[model samples]
Target: MQRFGWLFLTSVGAGATIWCTHFVAMLAYKAGVPVTLDPVLTIISLIVAIGGTGIGFAVATWRQNRLCSIIGGVLVGAAISAMHFTGMAAYRVDGIIEWRWPYVIASLLCAATFSGAAFAALGTATLGRYRIPVGTALLVIAIATLHFVAMTALRITPLRLSTAPLDSTQMHALGLATALVGLVVIATGVFAALIDRWTRSDAMQRLHYMAMNDALTDLPNRAGFQSELARQLGVARATHTRLGFVAIDLDRFKEINDVHGHKAGDDVLTALAHRMRSEMGRHDVVARPGGDEFVAITRFDDRVQLVAFVTRIEAALKAPLSVGPFATSVGASIGIAVYPDDADNAETLANNADLAMYRAKSEGSPAPCYYDAPLDELIRDRRELANDLRRAIDENRLEVHYQVQASIATNEVTGYEALLRWTHPERGSISPSVFIPIAEENGLILPLGEWVMRRACTDAVGWENDLKVAVNVSPVQLAHADLPRLFHQIMLDTGLPPRRLEIELTETAIMADRDHALHVLRQIKALGVGVALDDFGTGYSSLETLRAFPFDKIKLDRLFVSELEGSPETIAIIRAVLALGKSLSIPVLAEGIETGVQLAVLRREGCDEAQGFLLGYPHAVSAAGPSAFIDGPHIEPLPDADDISNAA
Candidate 1:
């Protein structure tokens, strides 16, 4: 009944109104003889009319079928006929009254036919808004026809005069009282209907609000954001104003969840959401689309204003936040795209902003990046490069180039480090610095890394001299791939001795997942392959890293070698590393030896081995002939700057 509250109110109102009208009409009738109505029968008739009509109204509207409506209407007509007959039975007159059966049957048929037609009309689509009024008018006609026809059936033979004859004035008073009471009952139902309508409207509004908001952060969700953005864009277009869309993605949020728990991550996100909301301007809108991502819309007049606003947001976001008992700070990469400037539509604008955000993430810049045409082109180019790299791995078109690693004291070649080189059929010799990152990002590094290891070992096994071959392993490969098993298989397939092969990795690679990477490295070490830490001083917790892994060699990053002559700090770091290597019984190799002086510095500092342009440029084993002399100074010119970044 609550679900159909309005229908319930309507049924009660209509039934009561029908019963009251019948009594009012009967009371107005001018009968010369005295008459009275039974109180018990009169009350009983009203109850029957209300109950029967309520059931009929509910059934008629319950289904859209015409048959159901007709059945319900007939039931209502029967109730009316029953009520009329029952009221007649209560009437007392000083005469013998009889009914003509034909007239009585006619009245019953008229009531049923007209009432069925009325409800059937209410169920018709064509009736539309006219259904209620039409149904009500038909019901009124049905009631009047039944009452008048049934009255005509009454025939009286006077037996005697009554002792108490009802006077006209007394009858008028009773009729007036009945009419007032009936009006009051009908009025109550109308008031209830009005109350129900107001309550329903309020409930719908609340439901709409819940649907548009985020439960966790109480921020506008994606649907709500899009609606507000479209409205703002319309206004911006009409007024010739600029609107900026800023996309923010939290960095290392996944790590936080992995380390502390998701509950801590949630607390952090909620705190950040509150801070962002507090920082927003009155006209600005901030929303969390999902996860650790947030988007904000701001109206600005110029680039200067936009920059200032973005700077403030960055500062506010970087503030310290509490996660349980501990306090930590999280950084965000923000990207911006402006209306009419970057894009005209919402989808394209959001996409451009996302592209800029990814670029900022790649560059690791503190400042937010704005969408530019070149960024889109760079993304397309990177995608194409990734595709080509995949094909290269499949076709074995990539090459392994080796640069000689020789002892600083003896100038005797100890080994060669294999560097991966890809010469695109069209682009020609794409640098490892550029494509290596792409490979790591797209998961091509696993195959690419394994291929490089296998090829290097195969080439080294065929060499005349017994020399260790070192292969660079990507951090992504080390963390995600089965490195120990892959290397073991490669060594077997290539017929290379495990002791003659070396695996080179950076400190950052081992730090990615210390327990797992160490577990993998230990497994590989058990196979008798030497492990070397490359780019030693460039990563975090250098001393801690050195203590954790038992390394066979430590390669100082080229950055320190380049600064050797100019910076005293560089020389001290080199000496300390070489001394540390000596104490640990490990060899220290310095890379990026461009001039003779850099080489001389390494020799005087007791560095064990070195590899750079001065020793030899990275030439293919097939080009250099694996047995080439190592003592002679290189006559060939040094590699250009583009080749320098490829230290793999």
Candidate 2:
């Protein structure tokens, strides 16, 4: 429509220029001037025509309304006519011809009629909307028809250049051609506009979809999940049906991603999404709310169906998945909350389910657990414990206990491993195995670890200078930015030489951030302190980890030492590890040496030191002094041959 209006304006302006130019040429001829066409005049006439057309095109393009386009077209035509007449009046004739009233009247009438026809075409084109080419063609036909009719009424002599008359057939053919051109032009303009609109709309729709979907899993994203949850909640309220929302998270997903590459992790998530979708009913909605997190919403007929449905989904997640070279087993811990039961709204329900899912993860299992008040209470207790842990170090409620490390060859005390112990005012004793991990997780280990190092160093100053004191360092503590400076300060404060302090770290700790760990270990070694790999065979330790760090000691995991007599594989693994340590100039210490046979085997395998209940149980600081416990073979003997055979 806009294009047609522009075309009409173009035609009207062109016709006006042609009529005015012809009338001025006739006037000059009547005045007895030699009517010779000059090159300058021709150029000026062409410029006027082209200028008028350009102005009309600009107006049509600018105005969207049909009426505005028509008015603009008429104004453009009047300007072109006036300019042409003014240029004609500039001519100097040889003699003056009388300005006859009849010629003047006829010329004015012709101008008015032509202008009216041009305006009519523009109005028609404008009414057709801005179909530029069609409007231009229509104006051309109308102007030609009006010009021929007005010419027939003129009293001037008609020129006959050939036998055929040039009036009727030529005029009719021109009109028809103009009309056809207008139709073609209008059709082309409309087609172009339609294509432009469609392409833009399709692009926008694709962008919208991309924004709402997860790139990795190709599932609805967090925004989409929230929208679906709100929609379902409304429907559930209206229909009085139960709506269940389950928040599911994969356990130890970060560990998997860290060990393998992100590409393998992505593949695992994609497979998990497909598995979840297959397990869900058609009406259920599943979405990836975030990394390794998925949410499901379903409208259940009753609570029983909801429970059964969640159970089925949990079982589906427990199945093993093959990713790249690894056959991995991943499980989902699901937390379910039903509408008007666990929560009445989306936010509350989602939050409560998330809290419950963490609780399920804390239980260390693959199962679905419904949200309840007890779980909330447990979370509160954990929070309290984290808060109280800060004061536990300052108030000296946390203390070090000594577990004796003895030489396997001589059966004499070599040193002691310093272990952290917490004695709660109200709860009595808390095991290091339990609270130590909690401290590491909640970021309390930075301070708690520093305290342990200082206390262990202070206590070791009391022991004989030849005996080493081992202090276990959690991975979180090892990752601390200021650990080197803190260790130096503790060494200065305790007046214990760096050689007397031995720091123990598990394999996982060294492998967690290999580069950073190496840098930290190098800094500690530069201070003349010894580094030991603790719980050596328990975690995913590549041979690279052992080769990278200069460990002074390797503590064999208790699992390998416990089954040494019963399983020949365990014994062989221990021996191989001991030999590897010797080859690297690192001493190997066997943990959990509880019997005579185990001790004898470790001694034969060239193990340097051992620590377990059979050696000496962890004792209080006062009982931790060198003279408090006996050190030689007479102190205690490992279990006899009968006991070892029965144990095996």
Error of 2 at 18 (Å): 16
Which portions of model 1 show Cα errors greater than 4 Å? 24-32, 38-44, 51-159, 162-212, 259-264, 302-308, 323-328, 339-348, 371-511, 514-648
- List of clashing residue pairs for candidate 1: none
**Model 1 lDDT at residue 91:** 68
lDDT of candidate 2 over 125-238, digit per residue (tens)? 445765545555545543344334333433332232234333334234434544554455456566656766886799898888788888888888998888889999999999
Best candidate according to lDDT:
1
TM-score of 1: 0.54
Query: What is the alpha-carbon lDDT for the whole of candidate 2?
Result: 0.72
Model 2 lDDT-worst window of ten: 28-37
